[model samples]
Target: MAFEIVRQECMKNPEGRSRPCNPEEICEVLENNQGSDAIQGISLDLSQVGDLQLSADVFRKMPNLMFLKFYSVGVKRSCSVKLPSGLESFSNSLSHLKILWNGVKNFGNLREINLAESKQLTALPDFSAAQNLKHVDLCGNIKSLKSENQLKSLAKLIVVGCYGLKEFSFSSDKITYLDLRPTSVEILDFSTGCMEKLQYLVLNCSRLKYLPINDICCMRRLQSLVLYDIGGLIDKSKLHSLFDALLSLKVIHLDGAFKLTDLPNNTKHLSRLRCLCVSNCKSLQSLSELPPSIEKLGAYECSSLRTLQLTSHFEPSSLADKKLLGPTLCYSVSYLRNLQRLTLKGCEQLYELPEFMDSLSSLSSLDLSESNVESLPASIKHLSNLKQNFLAGLKKTSFSARIAAIPRNC
Candidate 1:
């Protein structure tokens, strides 16, 4: 009978449109069919409703209810729906919930909850009884979240754009993926025995001045680590410590870190690292020997960079030495054997390429646009796999005809 009432209300609207339900109308339907065992689903659009006050046992009588979604669309004002305190339990069969309420006590069967963009939500309900909960996505002005020793089964968590969030910590050892991008979180506490199974972490907080390096080093299975715009938070020594611990990492992306002057001098320990990208780091001056496992290397708009050492054999003590003519090339040995794509665009101070450029036999695409490179090494003609070469703004170079004459039949 409850489903019949909801169906009749929907039939009054246009084919593909829904009429927003007010507080009184919604209360009437639920009250009239309070004990009905037929209500299995409910989706209400409360865009036109104002402040709604409901009893605590409103959903207690619906034993078979499995899904409940109460959302507002195109409403500019705060959508307030007050659920009374001591709301003991949702339906025992309920599995999915997407609402803006804070009174539910026992979510024994619930699997996922999405409260994204709930601007008025400042606190989370106790989830001690929610043993089956697995995924949670939270966003808005939430200030503090401490999921200590809870959510034993949680596997994924995302908390993006929470500008007012200041403190956060989760002790879910089963979690495999976590993202906290673009937040104002200042205190992130990751104590022992937390996030041990995590495989991916993306942190883009600008105000985060310190990272718990000891706790992060515990994530031995982490594969991808992306740190964006976290200015001056990680110095060279701390980064070196991180590299030593996170040896299983495959991809490392560092961008907009204005205080970084150099990467770790010896990355050969990261044997599995495949891609290394450092861009827009204006203060970075040099790149030392990288792991031979790197397939793609990109350093763009690093305005202060003056040297690139591709192998351990080529070492220069200082950038001021005029004798350091070009990229230190190894004539007898081939390094970076698996390298496929190399981009050094917008590095205006970089003046030369390795004279033994042919050693990079797997090189396919090369971009040196808007740089100060004087000439392309003649050895480049021997690269049989070279396909795309971009030298757009090299006005000071004398290799235009030489570059065009290279064979393209890769």
Candidate 2:
């Protein structure tokens, strides 16, 4: 009766033009009652459904309904569901199922399934028929599986935040992107041959002392790699080797790695690399050089850095040397004709301006705040197109005031 009403209303109103009576007006009482033997191939999950019992007739009526899901609806006690033996009639058709927050047990499936986060539940039935299952998430449960072979059919798996999981086993050929963060996992055995196609890898805050270099080297197509805040990753030998192995890498971000003192040895060889960010490394003293293909360089909050080298791939003669030219360290920064903006904040060692400062024909704005600079370069007066100039909180103000007082075109 319920299915007929639902189907008729759904089909009659092609564009949903008719309105049915509101659910508030409908009755909640279960009309039919039957014994448990009538139910077949039935699966159902419900949460906080207080004092609810499945009469055998209602169970048998849903012989074809194989999948069910239920969550908490404010019930004080768990709902105890009884499985009728009639399920054997439709066992082959009942493949996938889930029972969350419902006291369900002795359920069987032939293919895919999940039973996660039902604290009050215990006991798991053997699922030998579940051969076609590809993904499974059974987190937050303490019940131990009878054997690890149950997971052999799964390809992609998620067991995060599962406290009681001491150990398990499965095939790795079809699985990729396994997340073991914030766990007690000491070592991951990825010697399985299926890791070749893995691309994006993330190991943030894993507390790992080291990683499997061979496994990472096998992923030839790896594009993005992130390894931040790992405790024992002080030496760059392994990291350099890993970087050397990834010939197709495009982006590498390693932030807050306090123990990293030296840069990767062959880092400049990432020929196709575009973006590199190494911020908040307290021990880094200076940058030797960078790849010319790099488009963005984020080296913020790196206190130990003293020298910076900027180069281009066009030609050596095409580059200009502005080192120690004067009290301020400004040089062919204008040659970075492609440079859209420039900032020199807290550059304490700088004292003089580079001769190229006056010829920055492309610079729209300049910032020289919180520096030891005493005066603006006389060449600045020559930049007739100057729009915005930032020289706040300098060591001396008289020099800036005199420059501001000077007449333009002087």
Candidate 3:
């Protein structure tokens, strides 16, 4: 009973046998099974073949066609489909292909092409003879993209939400991961060199204006720089010369930039910075003094932070010791000694914090929730790996003598 050949039941409609076939009755049932070389695979559902127009050798007599899937459920991008301008007659045994049918111009041994959310795809199709393409997941409404040369085995390129991609250029020097998030790309032109082994770059474009920070400071094996919500068209001296030429940056997410305010005093010499996220940076007020190989620090809802100065020659005299060493409570004092996790949640103009917090010996989570910090620093019982201390929106309740100076298994 293995007569299972359901190419949509060969578009059956001998008077509506469970009706579901148009597009010239499924191109005349693939032109009468073009001699069928035992058709290897073909899964078409372009919304029940609504507007297909095949015949560029309609699968050239199915010579062992590998796999071809054209899916569409709830379709309607004007239901237009026109395949074949380089399935190039199944270039010697077609490999695998999913279709939105823009007539891919030959990518024979295809290795990957997601075509994410096609959204009436705008253009792409000249992958210079693909040569075993590596990875390309493009997002909706792509406006522009130029490649045509130097894709020597692409490594990874994800273009998300292409708004109308303002401008982008690539040549691929073995790209190591480039995510253009929320794109309306305002000219990114990676200075040709093609991101020399780039190691992860997510540009959350807020209409990014331009970027060529000396060819992204010659890459130097970039290690993760997500400019989430990048606004103000990048400035702050080119993000402090791209954090002093990306000294092998470990991770830096400037969440919702909002015109910064301060950060580059050589950001305490990024000695392989571990992680720093300036969450919702509502015009950051001060920070400069961090890189003690940070472990994880998130300044949530910044709201014009005050002056977080941990060290760099600690000098706090007054103004309430600089609002208890502002910037929502600085770090550094003996260099975060490997900070574990410290999130200043909604820093409501942070009131105070630094009584040197016992030099954070590998701090283990401390989030001052909705902060306006009233008090808490008798070195907080010398943290011995404090485990999660998130004071719920404190404005005052004068924490019973700092909760009896913490440490009762904190």
Candidate 4:
């Protein structure tokens, strides 16, 4: 009865039979390999009846399998194996189907899939014939697409850290690279039309609010935009024209946007921006209209921003957009001259440390943890390959006099 074997051609079901069998007479008697590390008995029931796990009696005897993979039980399985229904002739009988850790509900000629760490999966089935899927990694599942049309024929989907997803139905514009980072998505509605071939949009720590970006500008070939820890009701002035129609943006990451404050004015049209990261924006104060093809800038702990103006002191008048007062916010470190790596940890009203700092001299690596920094502005020795320097929550008498004048490469 069971005879499906793609690529090696055997398939014969709709009645025209060619049933044959013999995976050692329906698996269960093994020894040749001596129970390869026992995940179960008869060598995993003779590898689910020969050549890698496949149950339901291999559709009566090979129905045209192009490929079928099923490790079906690992992660210390005690019970996880009950997914083998007579797939409606699985897309004309298999092209490639991979089901692991069991629990899966059905099968389709999957294009490519990896249900890694299927922590007792929750939901995922009704796959409309997989429709030539491209790539899918249901990393550590807790499934929640409830059937967004069974993901309309995915292109590339990586649902990393899926904490019981609550929603994601922007349709499916042949997804380009949509990683709902560190998911727990609050409210994301990519304005319909199913994501018009989204380019690269990472919504990290999605606790979003009002993130429509004018419908994500219909993903006009979006380049890269990652927003992290997006806390409540976001409206950072439409985040600079919501990528001003993307025009192939470079890279922009607004980390831990704690109720973001401001950054709009079309952010100088991105102008092929390089990399700009506003970290832990504790109500970020200002950095208005930044756009000089920025080269990596990670504003640490924001702390109500203080100062950092380039392009000739960025004179945008009105008391330099006042409000930014304490917890120091870079009042000018030579305007991050091609900043390499700078993370002023927990800037606690930074205690003066920017005396004409040789324009970061392409600073290498610096993470002044929990600052209250007492001293160390000997121009930081112009960070020549500055190694690892983390002055952990200083105060020990200026932490040994700024850790002895930064020579250990900082």
Candidate 5:
């Protein structure tokens, strides 16, 4: 019986392919390369072979190829079948081309292009003439892009989830880093002040509703801004119109802005604003003034934040060791005298807590886990540096303290 079917396909497939490698054995590996007239680099991952065609010259016997990767993984619709185009004759020693999750869609002489998880790439071609392109990382569903004079020596443009891109007018002034996600862009111009070495911006668009930031030509060398989950489409009077020249914004991450109540009552002068991360912003309530150079203030899970304007003339060494306040049902913090890690974990409608809390004095660590905050503020016995999980939420909640002033290794 054909010698037991060739010994069960030669000892159960000794790591050998069953068939799919016949493009004349890919031109006998660029003419065995020793003579070296061609063949620089080439990777052809058939993605486990499917119907197999790939012929447009199969890279024309590799005319001094530079680096080419042709792979195939999955998810490709829209009439499909569009690979093997001849790659414009390797467009001058093709630089570096990476196409993942699917077949070749020609991109010769690239500098750096990574397309990961591509459901079905839509655009990107016409690199003007490939003037030493820079870098472009795409997540999937490209939609189309070929302008900005074909990416004028692009720097780094990352586009994620481009749902057939509604718009994108590039202006790469040697672009720094501009990340755009979930694009169906309603409006995005950055006010036309032009990409002046843009300092890191992640516009996690929730159908972006314009981003002019009170135009006078904005984005003044932005320091770091991540508008994560921008659902309410930017309110707060357009985020106070980006506080004048955007004073090199330090780190402002507005997470899940569901309809912010405030922030930008002129941040009192952002002397390099340190770090203000507002998480789960469930319609923020109050926090009207802040910025003695704000040294780390994370408002996490903000269920309608109640207080924390933090002032005592600000600047208490800028919150010293940092990590100040973030689970607000805010009972008040006597002007946060240099806080050092306060979490109020899960503030379950935080009951009553501000018995001056040992006057903070550089609080060591207090989390009040799953808070309904029963009690424990006999000034926390003068908290000398409160550690032991800050009496571990005074053990089993409702602890009003005075178990002999909590000691004996509590």
Candidate 6:
């Protein structure tokens, strides 16, 4: 039942092997072989089938099936597709399920469900029978999802684009990752600090003005944090203190924050930090200090930044001007030897490059696209190990000569 016979000779020989078939062929096989206990999983792409007459009875007979997935691009607007029903009673073996851009409305009896970009999916059926369910991702406009007791085991839930979802509740301490990036939830009350186990939280709500800072601090294990494309709802003061509270944090991404002028004061203390991405902040003037352990740094489109400072961990003798050095180094990025990739795209007001731009011997990549820098220092030719240097669409093509002069010696 898993493979379809391609020719008449194949069907004539009962012991012959079969080959993989298209979605239409698989549907025919499912129709003829009603009770297939050996087929543990089935993945179908029904985008080309104009009118599919799929039925639930065909799947109900497969007692041992564990995985089910259906992918359709614009199926609701392009064609008619009938999905299986009574999936809530799917055999206990069912675990993983995914439906992408399809017209499926209800599904159950699975431990995980990843339904993304399906605009026609309005609801998720009851989960009372899906006791094994643990993770669900309905990231696009799901309107009808109800509460149930089976959520106790749920570990990860991402409902980012569900605009009609006002609020949803769960055991705050049990869930680890919760992403409400584009949901219509106006407010979230985390003052009780019940989400101690929460690690990754993404919020981009339009009406959310204040977040539970104390609750976020209570999440001792929280690591990766992303606050994307929201208005100035969160106080920059609270965000500044998060690095001190979340010692396990490694990545921090904040994009399109219109009110943030400065970041956390003690960024160098983040021992395990690896990546820092801050972009699209219209009012962010400059960064006073950066962590010493960072490997990837992106400061794209911060139009107001005029100066950047790196951690003062290098000896003064390594720099050309020892008298100009301050408690924290400014324009001394040459000492950030651990940095492998750096991007400063779209900062339109900057007119000069750092004097020690080429001292970063370990640096492998640099991007300065769409920036207003008027000249590149002659010392940029000192970057011996640089692999990728991007300078697309800059003013006057000043970096062209310095880029062409780099020695080809490996």
Preferred candidate (lDDT higher): 2 or 3: 3
Better of 4 and 6 by lDDT: 6
What is the model-wide C-alpha lDDT for candidate 6?
A: 0.63
Better of 3 and 4 by TM-score: 3
User: Over all chains combined, what TM-score does candidate 1 have?
Assistant: 0.71
TM-score of predicted model 6? 0.66
Residue-wise C-alpha lDDT for candidate 5, range 115-176, written one tens digit per residue: 53443555555556655467766755555443645356777888877776766656666777
**Least accurate stretch of 10 residues (summed lDDT) in model 6?**
12-21
Candidate 3 per-residue C-alpha lDDT over 260-315 given as tens digits, one digit per residue, 9 for 90 to 100: 88787777778898998888888888776787679988899897887676555545
Between candidates 5 and 6, the lDDT winner:
6
TM-score of 4: 0.31
Task: Give one digit per residue, the lDDT tens place, for model 6 in 31-99.
Answer: 554445555556667676665555445555564454566567865655544544423233322323322
Error of 2 at 124 (Å): 12
Once model 4 is optimally superposed onto the true structure by TM-score, how far is the C-alpha of residue 175 displaced, in angstroms? 1.7
**Residue 253 in model 3: lDDT:** 87
Per-residue CA lDDT of candidate 2, range 246-318, in tens? 9777777776677776677577677776667665666665554455455555555556655554432323332
Q: Scored by Cα lDDT, where does model 4 land?
A: 0.56
Best by TM-score: 1
Q: How would you encode candidate 4's per-residue C-alpha lDDT over 301-407 as one tens digit per residue?
A: 87876544443234333454334322223343244556576666675555545566555567676676675666766766656666644455455326566666565
RMSD value for candidate 5? 17.0
TM-score to native of every candidate shown: 0.71, 0.48, 0.32, 0.31, 0.29, 0.66
Candidate 1 or 2, higher TM-score?
1
lDDT of 3: 0.69
**What's the candidate order when arranged by decreasing lDDT?**
1, 3, 6, 5, 4, 2
The TM-score of candidate 5 is: 0.29
Q: By lDDT, who's the top model here?
A: 1
lDDT of every predicted structure (CA atoms): 0.70, 0.47, 0.69, 0.56, 0.57, 0.63
Residue 314's lDDT within candidate 6 is 51
Model 4 ranges off by over 4 Å: 1-128, 131-194, 197-217, 220-243, 247-313, 317-333, 337-362, 366-410
